[model samples]
Target: MSAPLEGVRVIDLTHHLGGPLATMALAQLGADVVKVEPPEGDQWRAVDDVRGESRVFHAVNRGKRGVVLDLGTEEGRAALHRLVDGADVLVHSFAPGVAERLGAGAAELTGRNPRLVHCSLSAFGPGGRRGTDVALQSESGLVAANGGRVMPVPAHDTVAPWIMVSGILAALLERERSGRGQVVETSLLEASAALAAHRLIEEDSGEPLFNRFVGALYRTYRTADGAVALACYAPRLHARALTALGLGHLLDDPRFADLPSRARHSDELAVLIGERLAAEPSANWLTALDAAGLPHGEVADRPFSLLDHPDAAAIGLVVEVDDPTLGRERATGPPLRFSRTPPRPGGPAPRLGEHTAEVVGVSVGAGGGR
Candidate 1:
């Protein structure tokens, strides 16, 4: 069976993670995505090594065709216009004003194709005084909410891609009724702020206690071998957690009887719980916790390699693709599944200008444009 978006064509003029990931999601749903790169190719092509390819680039660019065109040149820009004229969707991640300067602005393209769904992904939004400013992960509120006073991984970069895809999908659905495509815009900053909605609500409620570190009942604890995460939300589950650690007597203690009091003494409670958990190995503790109806899991110490995982294979989460230069390579599969038309993993990421002749009927030159 064909995919849901089998007839939809997308012109992907994006680079790096955010925009590429957004276009990739569309491709996974069966859109005919044509990735347009500059003469030198996308930045991710040579991200870390000089082998002229990066696994991270291939991971997101899979299931799409690639073509190179330097929009800086008049001839190249004209070629892009031709591609855009036939496309149903267009995605770009240029800095503020770059798209307008390159003649790919929403106004220009939408005038040409009223049914085109144009999606723009940026660091900051196109509104407010700081609209043109470059907003990095640190500047976004996500780092603050996720790290909680410390610098943790910037999940916004990964999450912003999904937000962009969601915006594009919504626009597509709206166009079905309105019969006119619209510009869907999203920023890393805006996406990050939405992700911190819960934290923001708690702060506005005047009960800053919700954001307090000590208020957590589920958190990381040191075990005999390594760290483990504990999550006991319900009062009964909290009792079960104590029982699992052989500390059932604590449940009867007046000072530790209720949720609020337990939170107030969380630091002392954590220490006591850690001491008991340290007596048993993580595997043993996990089994005991499961039997006692407590929620807990052992923390993974190292990154997961893709040699072969049963779950990944069973759920079709990973796919293998053959690359001419890199030989055989594996990458993450599409995130969605359908009953009638399932997503099909396409070929490996293209080499620089690999499809220039095929897409534009022209050859690639050093300075760009045939």
Candidate 2:
């Protein structure tokens, strides 16, 4: 079976995680993605925290061909124009106005190919005063929102790529009907703002109660080993939770009988539940919770290592790539899966200018040729 985007050609001028992830998604859908790098190559290629290679870079740029060029040079610029001339999409993450300066802006590229989809990624959006600024995680409100809380992660950077990818796909579908391409834009700020959609709604509702309460039983509790997150919001489940914890007598107590009253005594309830959970290990509690049909699970304590995760392997989340320079390495697989034509690992990350000669039809130094 043919891939969904088998005939589509994408010129990827993106660097770092966000843009590459977007292009990777397209590549997974069978788009012919040609990654164009500067003479020095992407900065992410140097992130060697793991033993072998930069798994992060490999994860995002799989299923695509790589070509390095000095875009500042006349020859390189000319070659890039040639590649864009036949391309269906162009993905870039340069700061505001940089693309225009490089003569590869949305307006310029779309003028050359009217049907070409141009996707731009940035730290901030094009509208704000900091549009051109490359703000780190703290400036985007992402780190702040998640920090000092129970959950902490760099959600903005991690989620921005997927959002940009979705935006690009939507733009491509729109082009199908309109026969005219438009610029698809996403930013860490915007993506982060989108993530706060729920909080924004709650804030707008102007209800103090909505902000403060989490129901009585639907919260985190400490177990003997670690912690267990439990959700017994409904009356029946709450009763079951009480019985499972040997607190069935609390069901008769008027202070913990109803939802509103339970909220009022949440602290007391939490203390009681904590005391009970402290008596048993997390594994025992998990088994008991499962038997009681209570929604609870042991909270993992270890940091997430991508290597050898069962879900990752079962769903093809990681793939092995044989690199001519780095030997063999395992990196993340495509985020999407197609029933008809599933995406395959194209190859390992290329060396600087690895395909310059092949792409531009000219020979370079030794170990490089057409």
Candidate 3:
């Protein structure tokens, strides 16, 4: 099947994680995306390089042509305007008001091209101070909620891109009927809030939901060999787990009778369960859990272990691409699938100014700075 955005064109003016990830998804959906960088290139390109190519940059910038336009100069800004005039979408990640100074603001470009889908990505929403993943996580209560330990994964930076994609797609769908495009805005702060949405609820007494531990449920326990996560939260599942682990006597214990009671005596109940689980290897516990129809997973120490797992490959979650500098690379595949218009994984990320002449009819030397 043909790709959904086969004929669409996107002008990418994003840097770092959020905006680049969104534009990368557009390219995966078969859009003709032209990634515009300043003369020095995206600042992220200097971070964590492999053979002079930024692994951080390449991870989110696959399958797009690249051009280096120094938006600081009139000539460079003018070149960007020419690309925007004929583009279907434009995405930028400038600080709140920097886009206007660079002449890439939504109002000016969208006014010129009434059908343009202009998307602005920010660290924080308008009128708020600029922020980052760590700051937003703190402001959104994620840090406090997660026991005051900083998260290893960049939750806000990762989630904001998908949020941007959803907003941009909605705008594009609306344009089909209205014949006019609109501005789409998303921020890391908003994405952080979305991550904590479920935890936002509170009881009348001001007690937050799920704040207390509930026995041996919804947490990881160490086994003889490794660790396994158990999630027998519901009453029925809890009974099954007890029965499966030869602890059926606990089903009738007064202290472990219900959710509230379990929370009150969680430490004792956990000791009972953890002791039993530690008697066997993770494989044995996983097998028993599966037979009981309980939810569980054997925790993997390395995150990249999933790249080679058969389960991930079965769902097309892994893909391989050939990079000019890094050779063959294994990364995540396109997450969405359609029966009629399936999305395809994009090719390798382009070299800096790789398509400048082909795209703009002139070669801009690869000098540093915009």
Candidate 4:
């Protein structure tokens, strides 16, 4: 079947993670996305981590044509407006006033193309000072909730892209009815809030137990040989886990009577469970947990080690790509599927200004005169 966004045209003036990733998702859904970069290339291309190359750029920017525009010049601004005039969507990651200064602000673009779905991906919501994903994590209480340990992944940055995609799609759907488009905005701060929505609750009784990761009965434990993550959130699962671990006698204990009671006495329960877990290897405990229908996982020694797991490959969760900068690489497939109008796994990311000539009818350097 043809992809869902077969005829959709997108003008992508985004950089770094959030905006580029969002526009890439649109391209995967078969939108004709034209990625516009400045003469210096995306800022991600120059990050210090990778030295000579950028896996960050390669990871998120795929299946889109590329164009170079020196938006600092009037020639570049004029060329960008020409592209945006015929586009169905325009997404940018400019700071609050940057877009207006560059002449690509939402009001101006939407006025030029009334049917355009204009999206702004920001570090913070409008009027807020710009911040990075790590800063937003600290501000959003995620770092504290994570026991002051910063997550290895930039959670807010990664999540903001998907949220932006959702917002753009929703706006496009609404435009169908109104015959006009509107601005759809999202920020890393907003994404951080959405990521921790469950924990953002208030209760007059007290602070809700934030134990999904650290609860005695729900956290990872060291087995005799390796580690295993166990989760006995439901009463039935708790009973089954206790029975499977040969600690069924704990079921009759008052402190372990129910969720609240068990939670209150979690340390005691953890001591009991950890002792039993330490008596056997992870394989043995995993087998027992499986038999009891408990939720569990074996902790891997390295991150992304499960990329080669058989089940991951079987489910099409993993895909292989030959990137120009990173060489052959293993990457994730599309985030979702549809029966009739499914998204296509895009090809490798384009090199900076790789399609400037084809996309703008001018070579990369000559694009300034477009």
Which candidate should be chosen as best, given lDDT against the real structure?
A: 3
Over 241-269, each residue of candidate 1 has an lDDT whose tens digit, in order, gives 78777888987887577777786787788
CA error at residue 334 for candidate 3, angstroms = 0.8
Query: Which parts of model 4 are misplaced by more than 4 Å?
Result: 48-52, 207-214, 364-370
Local error of candidate 4 at 254, Å? 2.5
Q: Write the residue-wise lDDT of candidate 2 on 243-319 in tens digits.
A: 88889899789978866677778888888898998888888888888999888756667766655677789998877
Locate the minimum summed-lDDT window of 10 residues in model 1.
127-136
lDDT of 4 by residue, 78-196 (tens): 88988988899999998889999998998898889999998998877877788888899888889998999898888988899899999989998998899999999989989988998
lDDT against the true structure, each candidate:
0.78, 0.75, 0.87, 0.84
For candidate 3, write residues 222-278 as lDDT tens digits: 999999998887766777787887788986899887767877888889999999899
Alpha carbon lDDT of residue 304, candidate 3? 52
Q: Provide TM-scores for the models.
A: 0.89, 0.85, 0.95, 0.93
Which runs of model 2 end up more than 4 angstroms from their true locations?
49-53, 127-140, 147-152, 202-205, 209-220, 231-237, 325-328, 363-370
* Whole-model lDDT, model 4: 0.84
Number of clashing pairs, model 1? 0
Error of 4 at 109 (Å): 0.4
How does model 4 score by TM-score? Answer: 0.93
Pairs with steric clashes in candidate 1: none
